[model samples]
Every structure is written in C-alpha cells, then in structure tokens.
Target: MSLQPDQAIEVFYSYAHEDEKVRDKLEKHLTLLRREGVITEWHDRKIGAGKEWQNEIDTHLNSSQIILLLVSANFIASDYCWDVEVKRAMERHETKEARVIPIILDFVDWESAPFGRLQALPEGGRAVKKWGNRDAAFLSVAQGIRIVAKELAVSS
Candidate 1:
C-alpha cells in the first residue's frame, strides 16, 4: 500500500489569527516537504480572491490527509477552531481518514482540551514558545510531520 514517489499528501493547517507569526514560522519549516513534493499544505491564507472562505476551509479540512492544529491560548478560545475545525478533524481521525497533529505554539493549559487525548508535536507537548530555539522547535515539529506523512503514504 505504499504510495508512489509522485504521490502527494494533502495537509491542512488550523490555527488562530493571533498565532499567525508562529504558524508562519512552522510553515517555513515545512518548506522542505513542499519542495520535495511529498506534501501540499493549505491554510486560510491560501484562499483566493472572492472565494467563499468557509467553503474553501471546509473543502480543505475534509480532504486533507493530515490536519495540523496550531494549539495556543487564542486557538483554544476560538470557537471556529475548537468547535468546527478540531471537531471535524477528530471525526476524520476517528474514522482513520486522516491523522491529526496538534502543534503547540504557545504556553497554554490545553491538557483539558478535546484534542488532548491525541499526541502533540514539538515533543512532550511543550509549547514552541518555551523552546530555547524556536527554529529547533519548528524543526522538531516538521520532522514529526514527515514521519506521519511517510506512515500515511505506506498505509495508503
């Protein structure tokens, strides 16, 4: 069931606007995967002009094989991120349709969050902001994503 070399996995990023800086840093770290053509990422920022944002977000959220949640204080407070995106991602994960990876971006008490049952990135669920080197933190997250992508490819 291994995917072909040309196969590409779709990845969706769900984050709060307030954490855009960390999200951008994470996306930058993922550039290697994009360059290698193993994964294509989509976020709200990718929505084209005049496009129905909700529809666009829904389409990507449903179709992406992997969903990354940039968890933080703001992300946890956002109804849309928690109620809509994370909920849907959890559903897909339950059905084995996708893998959900929560990328903790800032110091936040998320142990009680719905996605808390799942494993988080940056290892040990440590917030990226707490890392001595943000770049190193992002690199760790990207490497975890690479492993997940490879596993999904094999399963597919």
Candidate 2:
C-alpha cells in the first residue's frame, strides 16, 4: 500500500476569507512536504484565471485525499465553509474517501460544530494565534499531517 515516490497526497484547504492570513501561515509550514512530494496543497487562490471558481473548488474537494479546515469564528460563520466545504469533507471522511483535520486558528466555540468530535491540531485545540510561538503551532500541525499522510499511504 505504499505510495509511489512521485505520488503526492492531495490536500484541500477549507477556510473563510477572514482567515486567509492564518491559512497562508499554515501553508508555509507545508512547503517541506510539498517539496518532498508527500502532499499537493490546493486552495481557492490556486484557481486558474479562466476557471469557474465553484466548479474548480468542487473538483479539488471531491478529489482530495485530505481536507484541512481552518477553524475560526469567521470560518464557522461562513456559509461556503460551514454549509458547503465542511459538509462535503464530512461526507468524504465518512465514506473513507478522505480524512478531515480541523485546525483552530482563533478562539472559537466549535465543540458543538460538525467536526468537533474529531481530533484537532496544535494539540488540545489550542488556537494558533494564542500560541507563544506561532511557528511551533504550525510545526505541530505539520507533524500531525505527516503522520496522517504516512498512514494514508500505508492504507492505500
């Protein structure tokens, strides 16, 4: 079940526009994995100039092996993230088609949210913004993603 050397795990990012900075920070931490070809990251910013945004997003969402939800008050309030992306991520997760990881980027009461029961990143649901060193938080997330990617490779 090992992945081919050139086979990159597809990771789709779901976040609110308000959380873009945090998402960008998190993406920075994933550069190593991306360069190593362990994962291929996708976000709305990657949409082509002529592509229909929603259709492009849905294509990536449906094909992603992993989905990262950047959780925040704004993200929770976002209709597209909460109603659409999260819903689709959950469906894929439940069907064993993809794994979903929710990373808390800001203080938010998301324990009652759809992905609440799942384990979150930065350890113990700590918000990345609240971390003493933000890089440490992103590092924790990166390590967790590495573990999941390895597991997925093995299982596949």
Best-fitting candidate, scored by TM-score: 2
Steric overlap count per candidate: 0, 0
**Candidate 1 per-residue lDDT over residues 103-133, each given as its tens digit:** 9888898878878888999988898989999
Q: Which residue pairs clash within candidate 1?
A: none
Candidate 1 has a TM-score of: 0.95
Q: Candidate 2: which stretches are off by over 4 Å?
A: 1-6
Report the lDDT tens digits of candidate 2 across residue range 44-151: 999989999999999999999999999999999999998899999999999999999999999899999889999999887899989999999999999999999988
- Kindly give the stretch of ten consecutive residues in candidate 2 with the minimal lDDT sum: 1-10
Instruction: Output the TM-score of candidate 2.
Output: 0.95
| Cα lDDT over the full model 2 | 0.91
